[model samples]
Target: MKICFITLGDIKSIATMKRALGMANPLQALGWDVSIIALDSEENRSRISIECNENVQVHYYKDCSAKEEVAIKTRLVNQICPDFIYFCSFSFRNRIIKSKLKHKPKILIEHSELASSIPDNKGPKKIALRLLEYYSVYYADGLLCASRYLEREYHKMARQLMKKRLPILYSPYAFNNDVIDAARILQQELNERYKNNTVLLYMGTMTRNYGLFTMLQAVEQVTKQKPDIKLLLLGRGRHLEEAKTYVQQHGLEPYVEFKGYTPENELSSYFDRADAFISPLNDTVQDWARCPSKIYMYIPFRKPIFTSKIGEPKEIFGDDGHYFNTNQPDTLSKLIAALADGRLQKTDVNIDEHSWDQRAVDFTNWISAQYAVRFAAAGSEVFS
Candidate 1:
């Protein structure tokens, strides 16, 4: 069998990109041919490389502008006629591909809580997007939800629609152990500088909805009582300036360090040095549909985690680490300081179940099953 995997970014970096890459490798290992199509740019093509020896090939098309990007994607779909096309997010490209393909299987994976992920809108743009979303969800052969929560939400919204037959697959984010081990060694070196201080690391994109502003305030509160605590924020986003402002306002400048836009290659080293990982994401309708990608990264380090009661993290951990109410700085401060408590140190958050390799293995089986069922349904003519 041949699978043509498609997405909008580099297959080696973004969470969805890496997951697609993971999907490609195992399928190839099982003796299937695989090809990946991404937003083919000169910069991305030059920087990224697929590791598979021969079974897999990566085709990059130069998309000069946003308009050109769509043109290139259309061209790739026409060229690579594989058994199935697995893609992330919904767009004009997916719709065009589905309409054009004669007998190809296509899976449209929802990476976020769609209705909630969009910003608060009032203009014509909001109205247009709402309509676009309705069609995108209705037309796909299969709808893959990143978590069970999203699947439930999807069903609730489209219960009356005929699209119920679309298979809802859970596509969780994953962590490669080899990557974790390498990151641990690098983290050890970084930790040497803050040996006397307890380093609290916050990984992933720093955004307003991420509750970094509130988390920063809580850090300020914690530092006032325990001056030995320090914070290292390791990602960049639109709200970075706001996070800096929170630090300044709370006089946390002395204790907090802003390490912006750390590459995925260098992330593990930062994770290694962190005495504890904190993601006090705020509770919003958006967060309720979110699947925290950071949790997969932090669990393998075997250090305790600090998070809010939002979406899948609470269910996944279930008292394995520390949990706090969202937006409550006093409670958050207590949770951060509580990590140093002797009892919390020994609380083992079981990460073996959450490993990327395991997730990939499960996904591999699921993909195979999807193929088998569809192929069987299509009868001898389609398989041949």
Candidate 2:
């Protein structure tokens, strides 16, 4: 079967690109023709180039006016005549594209709850965007929610719109095998630098909602009892400087190290040397919808993961990792102390089910089933 994957983001976007390719690669391996349609931007054009394989086709469109871009996408879809179209994000243009397509099955891979994430008082823009998101969900043949919580929420919303149940798939974020192999390589220097300390690693955006400050606070409390605990943060964001200021004000310089914005390929080296992985996500609509891709990225290294009992993490890592309640720095401090004292053990839960290959196979099978149902409804034979 031929499948066309579409994303509104530039091809070089770290998370989106990786996810799009992750799903495509496995489909290609299963002898399916997969094509990725991405918005072209100078940022992606300048970064790197993809070596498209025989089974997978890559197409990038130059930046254009909204009307022109939609027209170009419509033309491309007509030319490709794909059996299915998978969208990576929701936008007005994408919704319009869905409206234009008559027969091809479409799937919306919702990575976030965009409507709730938007702050209040944006006026008509917010209303329009929310409606677009709702219509996108209401009209799609199926949904690929990044977390179970997201699946439940979107399923209810879509049911409300259609007055019937819609197909929803729980496909969490995952990492490719290259990341796993790279993390297997050890860096002697980093290993030596962190040899004597209990290394706690946080690798993602340094934002408040992600609990960067909460982590710092917990680390500070942990260090008061165990000075050998080290917190290694890797990633850059708008709140990086603010976090640094808090570290300074609290005299956490000796306990914390910020290795800003490490490339995805080079992340495994940091992951290799860490004693544990941490995701201190706060409870919010935005976070509830988010399936922390970093957790999958950290899993291959066979490390203990520390996270608050948030939506996806709680559902996925239940009893496997250390879980804490919201706003409970004292509880987090105890977990850290246990790790520092070598009392906490790394989780040995089997992660084969979460692998990209498995996720892709599941997605392909689901797509096939959806297509069969559609064909049956129309009294036409489905593609084999």
Candidate 3:
């Protein structure tokens, strides 16, 4: 089967992009033809040119008027004539694309609810965007939610919007087998770099809602008592400058290191050096809907994780992971101290079931079943 994956965001070193590639790679291995369509920002184009293999066909479009962009997408859809189109998020463009297609199945892969994710977004614009996103979900033939929380929420939303139920699948973020193998080889090198210090790693965009400030505050307190503790912050975002300013103001330069925007393929080397991983997400609807992509990466390293006790993390990690309240920096400090003193125990959960390959197979099966049910209900001939 031929599948087309579409995204309006940059495809370079982003979690969503990596997830798209992960799904595509496994499908390709299973003898399915896969192609990617992404917005043509310079950053995305450069990354695609360097990282994507020759076998993977990629089409990029420069910034254009909304009408023109939709036209371009319609043309591409006509040309590819894919059996299915998997979009990375809900957008007006995607809604139009879904309207244009008659026989092809369109799937929305929701990663976040934009209105809540961007704390700064307010007023009528936010409300309008939220409605657009909800309509996008309503128009899609199916949904591939990143977390079970999202699966339930979007399923309900879609049912309410369409006045009927639509097929919804749970396709959480996961690790690729090749990436895991490569990371294992760099373990010794990473260990030698932080010889005596208790290294704690965080790999994601720097944002306020993600609790970068809270993490810095906790690290400050932890280092006061345990000066041997070190934190390596990876990835870049809108809050990078603000985070740096906070670090400077708090005199945390010695304790915190900002390693900006490491390539997704090279992240395991950084993950290998860390004794523990941390996610300090604030309590918000956006966060509740999110399934941190980094957790899948952290799991294979066999290190302890510290995260907020809410949403998907609470459901997936449960007692196996260390939980903390987002408002309590002292609690985080204590958790860090526990890790530094060799008191915390690592979770012994098997993660092979969540591998990208297995996820791809499951996704494929789910799609097939949905198509079969639809076809049978309509009393029409199946595609193949």
Candidate 4:
């Protein structure tokens, strides 16, 4: 089977790169010819992909103009001629999806988050986004869901809005074990500076929507009880300066450390250095709507993962996970304090079962079944 993924992002870019590559890699391993069609706004950026997956072909199409992009995409899709094409991140580049070819590629819509319900969006723009979301979702022959909440919601929405049920597959976000294995071999020499201090790490966006303030508050309280605890955050976002200002105003310079924007390839080194991790997930509409990919990244480390009991984290970790209320700083602080005083220990989680290889098995089986159904309806034969 051949699969082509279409996403709006630069080569090896952040937005859709993680999920695209995660699925593409395993599909290639399963003897499927995989191709990725990425769109970049930068005209200067090279069309070549420097990703580790050599088997999977990466074609970056320049988004200079809609007409030019369509021409480029049309030519490339004809050349790739995949059995199916997946339009990711609510992107509706359906000129090709609606086109004719020998393969007669089936369309699959893959959503990582609730695009229309994105936080801080308002007014006319929000309405425009909702319309766009509805357009692509309405056109899909099937849905590849990232979380169970999304699967249920989208399934119901299809029936109510379109009066037709879309075949939904719960293909949850997963961790790349390749990075984990590489991290295990690489031991970042952090003994000189952080020898005595217990490093509590966080490695994603620094925005308030992700609960950066709640984490800082918890860290401040943890520092009072356990001064040796150090909260090392390793990402940058809109709230970086604001978070820094809050840290300064609260006299938390000695306790908090913000190491801004580390590359994905080099993240393993820092992951090896950290003793424990924090994911300040909250109970909210936006939070409940999507699966947290960070939790998948944290689970493989088998370290103490301090997070809220909500959404995918609750489902993924079950009893093995640590739970805390981010709304209550003291409660989150006490959990961090447990780790600082040797009360909390790393878990022996069965990380192998959750690997991309495992996720690929589920994806391949489900997608093949969906393909068979599509053929069955059209009075055509399915794959072997």
Best by lDDT: 3
Candidate 1 lDDT by residue in tens digits, 277-365: 88766666567676777787788887877887667776776666578776687787887777655445555656777875576556655
Q: Each candidate's lDDT (Cα)?
A: 0.67, 0.73, 0.75, 0.74
| TM-score of candidate 1 on Cα atoms, chains taken together | 0.86
- The predicted structure with the larger lDDT, 2 or 4, is 4
Backbone clashes in model 3, listed as residue pairs? none
Q: In candidate 2, what are the lDDT values of residues 146-165, reduced to their tens digit?
A: 87777877777787787355
Q: On a 0 to 100 scale, what is the lDDT of residue 106 in model 1?
A: 61
Question: Local error of candidate 1 at 378, Å?
Answer: 23
Given candidate 1, what's the lDDT at residue 95? 31
Model 3 misplacement above 4 A? 12-15, 41-53, 94-111, 114-118, 183-192, 373-384
Residue-level lDDT for 30 in candidate 2: 66
Ordered from best to worst TM-score, the candidate numbers read 4, 3, 2, 1
Highest-scoring model, TM-score: 4
Q: Compared to the true structure, candidate 4 yields what TM-score?
A: 0.88
- Candidate 3 structure quality by residue, lDDT tens digits, 1-384: 667887676655434676666777677766566788878887776655544567777887777877787788777877787777777765666434556665665554555444544567778778877777677665677778887777787777777786456788888888777666664555677778788889988888788767787789899999988999889998888999999999999899989999897765567677777889998767787788787877887777788889987777777777667977778888899999999888987677678877888887788678768775222321232455
Candidate 4 whole-model C-alpha lDDT, 0 to 1: 0.74
> Quick one: ranking by lDDT, best first?
3, 4, 2, 1
TM-score (all chains, Cα) for each model: 0.86, 0.87, 0.88, 0.88
